[model samples]
Target chain A: MPEPLLARSALRAHVAPEIAAPAPGVVLRERTDLTLASVAAFKGREAELADAVRSAYGIELPTTPTRVAAGEVAFVWAGPGKWLATATGPVDFSTLPAAVADQSDGRSVLSVSGERARETLATLIAIDLHPRAFTSGDAALTHAASISVHLWQTDDAPTYEIAVFRSYAATLWRWLVHAGQSRGIDAKL
Target chain B: MRIACPHCGLRGVDEFAYFGDASVTRPAADAAETAFADYVYLRDNPAGAHRELWSHALGCQSWLVVTRDTRSHAIETVEAARDVALARTSEAQS
Candidate 1:
């Protein structure tokens, strides 16, 4: 039998000791526990796909750029008739009527929170992150430093989760660290 | 410049890629040579109120048809290309 492969973090080499220690203003952590999948509805079968997602995940499929959560499962609208489904535990995507592709290893999620989290993110994201404009549960598929990213707000603490392609994770980490430098960052992976 | 993406809301123009004129349509397989030449080589560089194609490369990744005034750089309207194509297909069928 072949040897089992071990999973390694995308930021393993880039996350230095100086960046990992706890800081006061901004807290950054890599979320490695969640399982991710890209779900795309078939043309002309959007309603069927939505129904299947609702029954299987106990959450409504978001038609707009928003995030909807039910229990441990959360769905963030990626594009028209497309969503990025994330769950902390195992999820059966087979029953869904749409096309589902595993993205657990294809992407990396980084969570940023704290008193100056919004300020730190402001330097990188071009869109408005103000509470009134982008409140909790809002999601956006935009770019940061010209690299494509899927960003979403989770709670009132103003915690934001950014998902980027696996290869760009290190570059994103560097950008986040630089952006949060003035505010101070507590980076942990 | 900013574009109001139908799916992702307003975003910077840098997030999108200009795909040129949206008025051009593919000719039939058995179309005349002149028709094919016009479709491939001929393009009208209108000075005002031009319909163009743009893809939201960084956001949502949706292709959009934007009607803009070339002289003033004012975007009159933006619609998803899929909807526009679907409408054309239905119109042709009808």
Candidate 2:
């Protein structure tokens, strides 16, 4: 398959990494609900928004998009000046670039990774998360983990999750476990 | 790709549509059809920063001008530009 985006340098530069857990370990977990901190921002002037996002969050978006027309995604627009990015994976919040700013309402992140991580998620997420179609650096909004979440497949982290509200963390985690039980993914974390 | 429209907020990248080369001006239709054909078809498939136009067909339904790089898959700029503004900008010399 094609190489995943956010390679060695990029992942190190952006991911807010925590130590990887053992195989079959608790790969997915959500901390106590913390108020949502801004996760993204945009700046334009000489077409510097990508740089801005890189400088701010260390994530890079594709340019001169050559894919088929994306006229269907606009159906969810809720504001005039901002779009909420799906925040997932390990984030290094302290390194957020100064050029960009975060303006998200109270939101938080969830961590999901482990040997059984894929199997675990497969039970709950109706969609696919294979490396080919939903590999790292890809983001999708879906109803999974028992909540509406912005899913991010982190680079090399071997973990993934749905970025959801603090209130939904517990329920989502519970759902993740239930889905995995059949496959023996009784992750306690 | 989920693009955050400066005017329409965060929307799926699919909702916004792409236009032709943003920096190139469409040749006159009355002129040689061949040159116009080349204008319409031939393009510089560059590896770096490229400016193009896009429209939010599913969201605000407004036109936008964007600057992006192909090699790196990095978005440079996504701006709200009307048809007239984009045309004028395309016509301007660097």
Candidate 3:
């Protein structure tokens, strides 16, 4: 069999060196909910959420420089004026960007591909994904079943990323599992 | 939508992107802060045809003016930055 085009370990490194490969057949769970987000600060004006988080804490989050291909990186927009770049690590969520990084808060990063990804997401998402409205790199930040999840088409893989508040990750995961089971597919990760 | 981005050639909706209304008039030189804020932030989402500014940020990265229906998402016009300025006044009057 041809080797897997992408090594999850390599991909993980591309996001963060601290995020090593998943254990053999064991996906990383400590940071079970994986998503990429960022905050692009322009002259330190516009919006801020990370700065506030940092003022309260003393750690800085990882941030990828803009203009690089998102293909080589996993990132997401965390807010209207910011983004959040993520990977596995005991990240200091309180860290904030200094300049433009300091201005914007972030946007969203959504997981949209998985064995039964579409089927699982269909329960909450409303955008028409039938080849017409969705293709690779197609993203939308709208309500899926009244819940806001930034949707993005991951590199044509079966695992997609979705971003939601920390409070709803479990509920969203449960919904995905239920939907996946209905399709005779088990979405364990 | 796959726009023929002036800079990046042709890219998917993910490569290029959208901005808000393009025809809204800018605030005058001594406009109040609130008025200026409204001009900069508020979008005129008319139900019918509208001129909107879009960018191929992930593509060629040039500014584009696209005429699309606010309700139906039908595009009636697509032009580069230079031409979009020409239609600005006519759009504001409509």
Find the candidate with the highest DockQ and give its number.
1
Interface RMSD of 2: 8.5
- Predicted candidate 3 versus true structure: per-residue lDDT over A108-187, tens digit per residue: 23344544556566665655555565655555454454454655555554445565554445555555544544454433
Clashes of 1: 0
Write the number of the candidate with greater DockQ, choosing between 1 and 3: 1
Compare the candidates by TM-score and give the number of the best one. Answer: 1
Docking quality tier of model 3? incorrect
Question: lDDT, candidate 2, residue A42?
Answer: 39
DockQ of each: 0.95, 0.05, 0.04
Q: Which model is ahead, 1 or 3, in terms of lDDT?
A: 1
Q: What is the TM-score of chain B alone in each candidate?
A: 0.97, 0.71, 0.68
Which is better, 2 or 3, measured by TM-score?
3
| Model 3 chain A lowest lDDT segment of ten | A21-30
**By lDDT, highest first, what's the ranking?**
1, 2, 3
What TM-score does candidate 3 reach? 0.42
Q: Rank candidates by DockQ, best first.
A: 1, 2, 3
Interface root-mean-square deviation (Å) of every model: 0.5, 8.5, 9.5
Worst 10 residues of 1 chain A by lDDT: A15-24
Off by over 4 Å in 3: A1-37, A43-73, A77-82, A91-114, A126-142, A152-157, A185-189, B1-49, B52-66, B69-73, B77-94
Q: How accurate is candidate 2 locally (lDDT)?
A: 0.52
* Weakest 10 consecutive residues of candidate 1 chain B by summed lDDT: B1-10
Task: List runs of model 2 lying over 4 Å from the truth.
Answer: A1-26, A31-46, A54-105, A155-157, A186-189, B1-94
